[model samples]
Target chain A: MYVAVKGGERAIDAAHAWLAEERRGDASVAELSVPQIREQLKLAVNRVMAEGSLYDPDLAALAIKQSRGDLIEAIFLIRAYRTTLPRFGGSVPIDTGAMTCDRRVSATFKDAPGGQMLGPTFDYTHRLLDFKLAAEGEVPAAAEVEAGTAQTPHIMSFLDREGLIQPETDSDTTPPDLTRTPLELPATRDLRLQALARGDEGFILGMAYSTQRGYARNHAFVAELRIGTVAVEMDIPELGFAIEIGEIDVTECETVNQFQGSKTQPPQFTRGYGLVFGMSERKAISMALVDRALRWKELGEDNLGAPAQDEEFVLYHADNIQATGFLEHIKLPHYVDFQSELELIRKLRREAEANNAAPSESAGASGGNLSGKMKEGAAE
Target chain B: MNEKTDPNAARKAWLSLLARCSAADLDALWTDAALDPDHTVLRTPEVGSVMVRGRAGAVGSAFNLGEMTVTRTSVRLASGEDGHGYVQGRDKVKATRAALIDALMQTAEADAIRAAVLTPLQAGMEQTRATRSAKATATKVDFFTMVRGED
Candidate 1:
């Protein structure tokens, strides 16, 4: 008996095996340990943590390693793993106001309430690459000191004190969780913030760039950018008090937006906010800009038909994993769609051929080109 | 523990009433509760109202598609507290217990129900898991058993 070809299973197995071999590379090369990735490849780990919405650098490192350095896949793994962990309770909101900030800077003010502390930043580093380190990685320790100088207060709070902006009240109301529920059209500030925090850093950056490039020009300034740890606590009924669960390092950015206030309300500086899981400065800034663009309506600014201004456009397309998955999955089999199009072409061609068999363009042809039937009918 | 009355127990009672009552009877209850506007469904509660879904499917066969009797009611206590209870299946007692849990939960008795009801339910679930694991262990079939007489 003859058997028909069924190569899919075998092909899949072979492909996976080949991929595994490639990931490991030559046997001579030392295999990359998770710790090595975590410590040395810390930036990649940070990106995964920021986008993944999971704070574990080790897990992100392992995911990155397993995914063969595909950052998006690493993020996808983190998100999937995050869903399995049950939430015992929620955290006490970290008062970013009371943040013992390591780094604080405001472009608008030369000297603000809290003194400026530029904590461990690569801002002033020359673009020149160090070739000496490439030979054998060893750098003479640069002088280091504790960034204990500035106690920066939220710039928005400073403006709020003068009654120059909408007062944002901190509350204990159950905030919207996007992971647990389907995203709705009319989202609250909480949901929007959640989306921005986990959104693709690059995508948010470009959208933000577009806004600045005359798209939805809302003059925004980096009012405050702070990076620090915040206490997480859970309410214990037995104890009748919230207990500290853990502390997580976060990067928060708040942008002061220039917008015309409504009729009742006076023109004041509105705000845009970004809060992410790690020390991700670029992501934080981009998120803040996009956040401001999305808040056109709530702040009483008119939508200027910008892509960044559209809430639906930005929120839906922000996540890299979702975007990449849908984009890449198109490489899968699409023979059925191709076949349908082919059949439609053949049918259209047959009709055209039949029409062309007999000359339709005769005398008294009006309006446009006509088939033979039209002219013959006119003669009859 | 309010020995006299449990809010969850009351919810259970209403749930059973819904499952047992006809469409007309449900409408009558709705009318009695003055819920036509709200569908003030003293509405014949339905089980399986909550949808369980995922990328793979229903958390790995933990459930199946089926109709469940559900009952729900909005109650007003003498002290003027309003609460809702929805319970699954036709068991009036369970419905009542769930309703009691809901009502008490809304009031200061939230911790009490978590202690009394949810904790126990979670314990029962854990026990079930243990049993399922133990049974699987007993009937353990090693699929990778080597062939003794091979060519």
Candidate 2:
């Protein structure tokens, strides 16, 4: 007789109680608020917003706090909450070209139209220990300038003017929404980009790194990276004009990959694109690289069989929620299967020893024959 | 194109203004109008969310950034004019009022609604923008360099 493991609910409740205590960590330290996370731990909030595909900073901060700063857990919380909300009609595509840039830079040109404004960045900061930050930190106010009226010209535009880069045809077709539909094989560029946008940041980063390290090596150069706010507009059918609805912060990345001329075409630079919510340049750049690598088929490049190049492999495993669920489920009970395997291995060992000791004796015995038949049936 | 002759263009501007107006402003406009407009709720005010998307590099393919809370409603005027309203945030009353205004604008009440609701809302929005810009300008700094006599 077997008694199954019970009291799981009570055990889970106790574990949760302990977890709450552990999350608090220290009594003297003050509790962190949602506003603090939203303002100070802004990058973490941005990541949750980007991967979760939801934009509310306040809700993202709350999720971060509830998940105890585990970003993937926060993203999972956001995604779960997002699915429950009713859908409103979609806004018209935002004009990124008209974005009021706060931080815009280009690596492709020596001096671009928008003079490389290195707005608040950690790129130049020395990674030295700051003991002052551990106690009470004070930040000096950054210099201010009138917000520029001119839209920062894209670096790729210059390349396009020279006929050096491939030109993309304007598309009027509505892209498929993965949230509404089941993911099918051979996803469109739009669908692939959507998966990469909300994909696990670290997983996409690793895949991008693999491409740089000889697998589907595309020799990517950062053509342009811009972080700014753009106005959202919705077209009213009754009224002939579209009107501005709201504004949101976004980060956009465009990478110019290696140039090549196919048999019929002239040499032209290819492009990789990435766009994410808030100021997440790293994710944007990584997404762009991975995006370009996945476009190998459309570009008529040979299938180098790179992980980044495999659309099915990348899109299917990109979602952290699904990946984590499958990974964590191994902790569940499997004792029955383990016990069966154990018995079979023991029986096999016994048979081998019996055959070695007295092969003819075992072969002639009716009892041995019956047992052997039962073992064979069990194996089958 | 003259806005006077273009009813569609003028209506769009008014609708957009209503969508952007604060809940209090919308209410004040409604009360101040003193128009006992008869209307039926075709669709009850519903609170929902929209997944806002952005194009990569502004011209590339679109990607979802996040969701924003919105309230929407539809109403029909007694005269059979239909109107709809969609606004950011979770204000049901504001959304309903907007829909009412939308319907009335299409009916014979267009001029009266323009004078009562649209004008005040537009003024309020412009004031808000001006105040924000003025505050932002106070912190503006311009960098310049002077040539020295030594040079």
Candidate 3:
């Protein structure tokens, strides 16, 4: 007996079960803990924090584990959870100048306020694969060093002192939160920066690369990039002074851009800024380039209509969670829409076939006007 | 997520109320409100109500009880403009308030109307919610009675 398929839900459950088994791998191997992932696979945790816009490394690690190391899926889980959270209120902006530097470098200068200290980087490491890592390797010895007494001040401040760059004014106006609200066109600078801070790393990198290769070319120099932990503090209304709530790792990048001043304005250097959760330098730098490109209108530069320059397009499509959710949702059942299209095509084909046959049959004895009715239907 | 505060959902509600109403009623409401004729163009849509059912939790799926208003409406102004508003609440005042803004958008002072009428109504709704919550908290009943037991 012919019948319509009714086991779609059942099949989905079975498939999910199979996926879970695949994620766990062999039964003989011990399942990894969230703490272990957070400590050992730290880069993944950083990416999750950067995109998810959540600074909690532990929750990000758990999400990574639950999503079978699919970083985008982890980000989606974090974002969905983040939306449900009630806002206690915003903390005062963290001062990165007071951050105890773990890694500080300036591409523009050899020695800045904080000397270049490349802490915990794979930059100098050999590219050879290590066979020892196949099995869990022993921990390395701790670095021999005195107490960390010095803190890193921002490199942009050096240029700021000389009046060589534009000063980012403190307006005390709160920025728009994209997470809480739907995005609208003509977003502000603060809103754009927020979007870039949580934007997809690879997408930002590609756009940055395109700019360097001469599409909507805005000359950019990596003025400074810093990675460190900063303290988050919230002020109690009754107490007046703010108290430290917690600490979070952040990577900040500033790019010096060449901007020719207008008749009303004097010649001055402009800047691009990038701030991301956790220690992600590549993401932070790339974010800066893309940020600068988006400021074409405010900068009084020509609108080349580049992908990076269009704030509406970039800000709208940045988050991997939103992009992946919308893209993957297309895979959901659309049989109803497909069926309607199928019926229309079939009806049109039948009419065309009948019209061709009618001319041959009615050519002998009647008014052969199949084309006339087809025209009438088309008109309607 | 609170659909009550969702602008799109609220707009839909306003539009649906407009559809269920007569043109005379809409005109009377606007006329009574003393809206400028040169600025307004009102167009209401055909809407049918439905019950939305679901589940809720702080960390799990939300349950939507099927008893909500679930009104959907569309509006267009003389400035070749269109708006879609949806609300799941049965507050007729809210529905008309949204329609009035949509109608007034045809005028040059559309933004002023949006700022004055719509923004305040939204703020008032939020204020009313806060006040209601405070009142409920003030009257919160706590039962405390002890039974003596021998071990």
DockQ of each: 0.01, 0.27, 0.01
Q: Give residue A366's lDDT in candidate 1 (0 to 100).
A: 39
lDDT (C-alpha, whole model) for all candidates: 0.59, 0.78, 0.62
Task: Kindly report the docking quality category of candidate 3.
Answer: incorrect
Q: Order of candidates by lDDT, top first?
A: 2, 3, 1
Q: In candidate 1, how many Å is residue A249 off?
A: 1.8
lDDT of 1 at A282: 87
lDDT of 1 by residue, B28-122 (tens): 33345342111122323322222111100101111111011233444444444444444332334443333444445556655654554455454
lDDT of 3 by residue, A1-380 (tens): 12234546887899999999998999898999998999999999999877887666777899999999999999888777666543434555666676655666777877665466666677778978988889876868434344233445678877777877777665544555666577778987766776777889998898888888877788888777777755554443432433333455677788888966878777778888777778898898888888788888877899887888888778888878789988997765555555556557767866886788754443312222543444333311
TM-score of model 3 relative to the true fold?
0.65
Q: Pick the candidate with the highest DockQ.
A: 2
Instruction: Tell me the deviation in Å of residue A297 in model 1.
Output: 1.0
Model 1, span A54-142: residue lDDT tens: 66666788999989998999999977766654443444455556554546677776566755556556777896897886787666643
Q: Point out the higher-scoring one by DockQ: 1 or 2.
A: 2
- lDDT for position A367 in model 2: 48
Give the higher-lDDT candidate: 1 or 3.
3
Which candidate wins on TM-score?
A: 2
